[model samples]
Target: METFDETDRRILSVLQREADIALEELGARVGLSRNACWRRVRALETRGVITGRVALLDPAKLGFGLMVFIQVHAARHDAEWLEKFGRAVREMPEILGVYRMTGDLDYLIRARVADVADYDKLYQRLIRKVELNDVSASFVMEELKDALALPL
Candidate 1:
């Protein structure tokens, strides 16, 4: 990744809060001319710092009331099995995120479902699709904080 200058950092900080902010407004806030600010923003996007803008949604309103984290342990590290597991995870709508870990678990998954029963059904389907040796799930009772913005 390319190192960001002070101006670039300022631009990123403001953009993280509100990606829809107008280019003129962003330039004004960062004390840059419209053209300079536009170039900086374009560079950020080109360098993959700004991946893409998106609308943050309410999970509950979207019919995903239950948030659960699952730790999955695969039987072994086989290329074919890993590929299949990755593909299954990508295809599962309920699985919002997946991370390969360095701890006791092979993979950590974040998923949202309707309820406990819904989670149970998802669990069954997930295990059947992947050759997981062990699986542990924990339901989130209260979400204290969830922020996607990086501290720039």
Candidate 2:
């Protein structure tokens, strides 16, 4: 892992929330010159500290109001089963995130859809691809807090 100084942390903390901010302005915000900021950002990119920037979209505004968290128990814990499961989940656009867990649940899947019906379709598609021992879903009625920014 690459070690980052306080300046890098400040730069990253600011950039996380305002990815498209102009370098000159970003430099001012982070207390650095424009060229210095550019160089640091370039180094960050090269070291994989900064990944690609993307627009954050509202699921509700896009007609996808339902957010579901699925707890999946795998039928098999072998490498082949893991690969198949990963591939299956990765192919589904509705699935926003997939996480392997250390608890009773083998995997946790976060998905957004238009409604329960859309989620049903996604569930059907998921099961068709891989055999799961058990699948439990929780629908999110309200999101208390949702932020992609990491604490510096």
Candidate 3:
């Protein structure tokens, strides 16, 4: 693992919140020269500490207001089944994230769509590609906390 000092941590924390902040402005906020800040940022990127930056858009404004969490139970827990399932999930635009889980749930999928109809369409498409033992969905009523930034 790559080790970082205090300055690197400060830069990461600031950039996580405001990735579009100008180099000079970021440097000023973090108490560093613009050139120095740029070098550190580049180094962080090289070390895989900083991945990619993106604009976080509001789902409601974008017409993808409905968010649903799906618990999936696989019919067959084999390499071929997992591969096909992975491909199906990756190709679906509505599926934001999918994670292999422990306990009763085999997989957890997070998705966003326009409404119930859209969600049903997504569900149909998913079942067509892979065989699932059980599939259960829970709609998100309220999102109290959602922070993409990891603590430095």
Candidate 4:
């Protein structure tokens, strides 16, 4: 792990919240000169501490109002089955995250859709691409908290 002083933590915290903030402004917030701040940010990137910045979008605003968690039970546990499933999910735009899991479920998929009809269409498309022993879905009624920021 990379060692971080208080200044590094401050810079990371500010960047996590406001990635596009001007370098001068960011320096002011973190008590450093612009050049120094830039150097540290570059170091963080080089060291793989800071990955990449992205714009977070709202699913509702984009006409995808339904969020579903899908529990998938694979028909086969062979390498070929796993490969096909991975490729199919990678090509699917609606799938936000896919996880290999323990317990009763083989995999878990997080996805967004317009409605139940849309979700059904996604289900049809998915099944046509890969075989599954069983599948179940749970719709999110309310999202109390959703976050991407990791603690520094």
Question: What's the number of clashes in each of the models?
Answer: 0, 0, 0, 0
- Per-candidate TM-score against the hidden true structure: 0.95, 0.97, 0.97, 0.94
- Using alpha carbons, what is the TM-score of model 4? 0.94
Q: What tens digits encode model 2's per-residue C-alpha lDDT throughout 63-113? A: 899999999999998999999999999999999999999978889999999
**Which parts of model 4 have CA positions greater than 4 angstroms off?**
none
User: How well does candidate 2 match the true structure in TM-score terms?
Assistant: 0.97
- For the record, the alpha-carbon RMSD of candidate 4 to the native fold, in angstroms, is 1.2
Model 3 bad stretches (over 4 Å) = none
lDDT (tens digit, per residue) of candidate 3 on 1-152: 77889999999999999999999999999899999999999999998888899999999999999999999999998999999999999999999999999899999999999988899999999999999999999999999998898878
**Clashing pairs in model 3, backbone N/Cα/C closer than 3 A:** none
Superposed Cα deviation of residue 106, candidate 4 (Å): 1.2
Instruction: Work out how many backbone clashes candidate 2 has.
Output: 0
Could you give the C-alpha RMSD of every candidate to the true structure, in order shown? 1.1, 0.9, 0.8, 1.2
Tell me how candidate 1 scores on lDDT: 0.94
lDDT scores for all predictions? Answer: 0.94, 0.94, 0.95, 0.95
lDDT of 3 at 137: 96
Summed over model 1, clashes come to 0
Q: Pick by TM-score: which candidate is best?
A: 3
Write the residue-wise lDDT of candidate 1 on 1-152 in tens digits. Answer: 67889999999999998999999999999999999999999999998989999888899998998999999999879899999999999989999999999988889999999999999999999888888899999999999999988988
Which residue pairs in model 1 clash with each other? Answer: none
**Model 1 / residue 100 / CA error / Å:** 1.2
Clashing pairs in 4: none
